[model samples]
Target: MEEVEIEPLGADEARDILAVAQDRRNGTRWSVALALGLRQCEALGLRWKYVDLKRGTIRVFWQIKHQRYRHGCKDPHACGERLHRYPCPKDCPKARRTSGRKHVCIKEGQKFCAPDCTKHAPSCPERVGGWTFVKPKGKSKRTVMIPPPLIPLLKQHQEAQQAERQAAGEAWQDYGLVWCHTDGRPIDAGQDWDEWKELLRLADVDKDARVHDARHTAATLLIEQGVDISVVQGILGHSQLTTTKRYTHITATLSNEAAARMGRALWG
Candidate 1:
């Protein structure tokens, strides 16, 4: 198979990004995304039951998607096709880039197919439903250990969420996600793009960075910390050892050190 070159931020950049997000609203969620190599969907799907604060572990067993919830937008700024929480802007064009099978462009708010742009357009799902959460690309599911610091932050978040729930009373939706809207609804992935880009811009990081890069960030950091490749493979739940190999981006010093270690092992 051809090699897949993964792009993770330099350690400094990653640290800066995490620092910037540390106190932000979705800070814990973003931290987990980088620390545990979770796909956005996996993070979205997380529930309280899956987390074990006492044990310092969390389960990764399901993904979340809010399907078929439609908002009928009106003209002048209309998404006439009923939408889920993340509806496309009325001005969204029919022709746009397809970022995986979700079809709707989170950055551009453009629907996968142009409005009546194709003969099969009527048959397309985006015309009726909303974006679907997918698994980590071409990989199976696996759990990874959480960083020690994040565990307490998670506990604090849960406490804060409980306070919010009490404040809202009957208004809280109780979807039980670790990452969710203030009212306990699923976060709209399409709507998050604007804020994500803005976060990157404010941090002086690449404004064009995709959120999926967090998975790459976690994987690369693991390799840098001297974790075994086979362990990373299991953490990432890759179908093949080679699939996990694609995520390893080593620094020159580390590469040189690896060579030296091998040489010592051979000569000494």
Candidate 2:
């Protein structure tokens, strides 16, 4: 495992990197992935179905697995770390009344009261009216609430995606997001990461920065801006507060600020 470090990128460097992706026409997904500290799989697994635009809430579920359905894995220790699927809720807000797929319907007030529903597997529909949530076997699950600063960008990106879909016209199959390769296929995680790093290099950033450091960057910024450590911990989805604290680096700027504050308090 790579040791985590507090590697801070200059704002100009960050901006340049983001611009490169935009210039290349790689959607905001890459930038958003960096901004939100989302894992590669989590970002790749992102779909229109999970995004709640009106409320500005993005559901952090679903995992793109390598092979086999991890939902049924019995390993108690390994299960939580494994990728799992996010089944559509019968009462999901995103669900719409589509004539095509019954499972895709988001009918309001209409309970999925079918005698046997396809969503609830194994058990007969007669026994269960509907599924409240998917029960994927996982214990090491991590979920982080996004910061307020990132919410507006998410909304803007959603609108941009809609515009792109409209422009695509008949060719639009609604890949739900623009993170995938040109063909709408899932990009290989490692290769995609390498490409992003190369983009960063072209933008004049240090070659040593890892894609995962963005999470650290977000948390570090919060701390430097005087946000409470506990709040940063919650936003970073760290199981322990110590993990969150590790990302924060007290810079010379902070030290100077503290000295100036003390001087004013003592002199003034």
Candidate 3:
């Protein structure tokens, strides 16, 4: 429903973004941002098992479900945008329980409910535990080849992470994510934006270019360089060719030049 922004970075600006990302100590995320065009959420959810450095390919299947901000819904009918709209009240007294026993709200200004979800006709997933990682959009899965130049950078980063893990020993939480904190837990997607904005500012590029525009940059650059449309579509994991079209931005000068070149070859 929302129109996609046409904000592909030129080669120079792309280089600058990568340069600044390295300067800012976020080389891995920025490299993936430009090279593979991964959404920040997808990048954050990546596990080490999905990354094949030997083969220069990365698997994309899951994304971290963002759930820190909003809680359960007051609306009884609507499930709300988030599934964790309703939460099990851990501190409420017996007065709030679905059971005949009494309950009290120890924590104020927060909705509380018990696990006895029979209050709703069919019940809801919110009645379950909190939200965690979720499948990719439409559950679409794809493998993307890493850029040739980025393989070595990834190797170096992995070595550094290995050292960090060794140092942390026992304290490290091994989530097996490709990119994580010193504790080995996945990076928070919500926190990714702050670094991205700083990177854009340092690069001196248009600040309005959303982090998602990096994905568009990848898609558009590959197409302009004459890769087959089907291959581009597959790389983008787009179910509809039309969706790929939204991501592609063909400049008028390039289009006219292409037309003239074809005419010259055919007639002259």
Candidate 4:
């Protein structure tokens, strides 16, 4: 596979992109991408339940695969035929339940476990949970947080989204303040990206910039602003510090700026 490079657009370019993406849905997707530094899939997989518009926070829960719910034999030793969740080794009586919530798992007509099941159950029926973010084909999933400056914009955007939903009459799904469609469906991230790219072209910016670079921009901006590296790591949701160290050069940049200021004060 070819290496994927993340190159964030300058603020001017981001502004151009946003200006060109005139559609409300597309704009919201771009705003979310710039704010949360979410991968394409993470943004697309975002559900109504995960966003707290009131609190200005987005929670990512689960990801949808191409065969999201396609069930089949998961055990390596079992026959190589794909099975539904009900027929999987995890749900079979012969399989050992390792650990996890049984929650309410009803496959076909038979009951698999309670709805509130956890990982502690002796015969865990639920498949092991993995990372929530997904990549389309060549991309990787990266979880990053919204910047503080964008918080107000997100709030205003939520209000506008709510007004739009209300104008749609009774067809809207009521999730109470979520910045989604009137029917309460999560915005499709891939479609959103396509629209955003078109918008960038319209705004007279380079269309070659990948959406993932917005995340890199968010991180780079924060580090340039003298925000602590650890805090950036938390906001970006990086599992390790090494992943965040790439932006340490911004810290040096800031230090150079500070030294310049000191020189002006001392000599001039």
Best by TM-score: 3
Q: Which candidate do you rate higher for TM-score, 1 or 3?
A: 3
Flag clash pairs in model 1. 71-83, 94-114
Better of 3 and 4 by TM-score: 3
Please provide the root mean square deviation of candidate 2 (C-alpha atoms, Å).
15.7
Put down candidate 3 lDDT per residue, 177-203, tens digits, no spaces. Answer: 777878787676556776777788888
Ranking by TM-score: 3, 1, 2, 4
Note the Cα lDDT for every prediction shown. 0.69, 0.57, 0.71, 0.57
Q: Write the per-residue lDDT of candidate 4 for residues 122-200, one digit (tens) a residue.
A: 2334434322334333223333444466666666666676777778778875534233455655555565567667776
Q: How accurate locally is residue 215 in candidate 3, as Cα lDDT from 0 to 100?
A: 78
Highest lDDT: give the candidate number: 3
lDDT tens readout by residue for model 2, 126-235: 23222122322332144455546656666666566567666767766544543554434455668767887888778888658776765555556567677788876655
Query: Which candidate, 1 or 2, would have the higher TM-score against the true structure?
Result: 1
1-268, model 1: which lDDT tens digit per residue?
A: 3225456766777777778877777678877877887776778778888899988888787787756643232231233333322444546675344653333335444344345323332334445445354454555566667778889998888898888778888989877878777788878777565655666777888636777777787788888888999988877666789777766545554687789999999998
Ranked by lDDT, the better of candidates 3 and 4 is: 3
- Residues forming the 10-long window of minimal summed lDDT in candidate 2: 128-137
| Estimated TM-score for each candidate | 0.69, 0.60, 0.71, 0.56
Please count the clashing residue pairs in each candidate, in the order shown: 2, 3, 8, 22
